[model samples]
Target: MAQLLRQLERICGDDHVVTHPHALRTYESDGLLQYHVTPRIAVLPGTADEVREVVVACHGAGVPWVARGAGSGLSGGALPVEEGVLIVLTRLHRLLEVDLANQRVVVEPGVTNVAVSHAVAPTHFFPPDPSSQIVCSIGGNVAENSGGAHCFKYGFTTNYVTGLEVVLPDGGVVELGGKAVDLPGYDLVGAFVGSEGTLGVATKIVLRVIPRPEAVRTLVAFFDHTSEAGQTVSDIVGAGLVPGALEMMGRLSIEAAEGAVHAGYPPDAGAALIVELDGSGAECDARFDEVVSLCEQGGATGVRIAADDAERELIWKARKAAFAAIGRISPPARGARADRRALA
Candidate 1:
């Protein structure tokens, strides 16, 4: 162990290697705090080559290792192994390139999900925005196929990822896809994205970006019953109106969120639905009216539509805050886990 530690230190510098008992504890668990295992060592490589060297050293020494991004994943995918190396990728942060002509963006694994959209803002944006986008790293997003709000229209993390530079388990480096679309050979890129880090470690990534919509509208519809909210969602979708986001929240989460962020959710509401629609101004205006009418038909007791971007952002803030808000009210139950099988 000492020999491998020294080798790792030599590869990534003494400052980058974390072996202190207290510091190692920092990598013990990811967002899933219920599970914890203090790693023997942790390393933060500063570049693609450094990452490969660290992985190579671990492979040669027969030590298992885990790759971690921002450690915001709740699925325990970034959980540190008891006796393994925890390779933190945040040091690799870089927006390598942006090509609007090609609609492609190149980034290192450590770039946050929201950063992609910000870098291409006003003209284009990355669409797979998980609730944790602001902090979640693109590498982890690829591993988990994270999806939020616009996922209903733009799809998951896998959809935006066009290419990856991977360091295999045995220290071999390979390119899965490219800036150009529809590459020949096996769809290794597809198999690797959501593998939760089993296939390999992504070093560099190529992402697809889309042009921003001309107009957008957001609304929060309140219903006396969850069934009514559910029916309202059905009505909108059935009417061929594709909402950018159609998130439903029940009384419990709604109350928790209101208590935390005060996002203007009605107190007496049994259920709330956050619906976002985007397109040309005329199209959004035409469809927004129909969506509002359908909410009424579905038995909505009240509805709040975002009057401006500020209001729309607040409405989304409430929805995204629901998970953490609940935690403030009640600590996570022992042996508890998120039911990933549940639909959004």
Candidate 2:
């Protein structure tokens, strides 16, 4: 262990290699707090070259190693291995390139999900917006194939990721795909995106970004029953109205979110649906009105359309905060989500 630690220190500076028990405890677990394992050491590699070198050193020493990003993942993929090397990638944070002409951006694995949208805001936006986007790293998203509130319309992380610079388990570096669409080859990129760090470590990622919508309409529908909210979603999809985002929160979920952020949720609601539509101004307006009618027909107790962007953001805040807020009411745990149809 001492020898491998020295090798890691040489690869990434002494300041970057952590060995103190207390410091290593920080990497013991990710958002999956139910499981924990204190790694023997954790290395912060500053660049792709450093990451490759650290991995190579561990490979040479035959020591097990795990890759980690922001440590915000709840899937337990980032749980440290006891007596093994912990390769922390947060130091690799960087926005490498922005090709507006190609509608793509290249970023290091450590870059936060929301940071990408902020980097390309106003004119463009990244679609997948997990609740933890502010802190979760792109590498973790690639590992977990995470979906966000907007995934119903825009798709998951796999849909936007066009290319990856990955360091294989044996410490060999490779490029899986390019910016081009549908290259004639095995779908290696697809297999790697959700491998949960078993296949390799993503050093760099190429992501597709879309033009910002001309207009967006948001609504929060309070329901007397969860079944009605589910039926509303089903009806919206059945009507060929693909909303940009459709989110549902049950009674307990709503109470937790409202208590946590006071986002103005209806106090007596049994369930709530936050539906958003985006695209051309006229299209969004028309579809949004139709969606309101669907909610009413589905037996919505009350319906509130966001008057402006400010109100829309507040609605999203409540939905996004709902996950963490649940911890206040119960033991902190990342609950499993069933298929959207399960509500119905």
TM-score of 1: 0.94
lDDT of 1: 0.91
Model 2, residue 86: distance off in Å is 0.9
Show model 1 residue runs off by greater than 4 Å.
179-181, 332-344
List RMSD in Å for every model shown: 5.1, 6.2
Residue 216 displacement in candidate 1 (angstroms): 0.5
Please provide, for model 1 over 1-344, each residue's C-alpha lDDT reduced to its tens digit, 9 standing for 90 to 100. 99999999999999999989988878888888889898999999999999999999999999999999999999999998889999999998899999998899999999999999999998999999988888999999999998998999879989988899999999999998883547577888899989999888999999999999999999999999999999888889899999988999999999999999999899779999989899899999988989999998899888899999999999999999988888877955553434333432
Clashing residue pairs in candidate 2 (N, C-alpha, C atoms within 3 angstroms):
none
lDDT of 1 at 214: 94
* Clash pairs for candidate 1: none
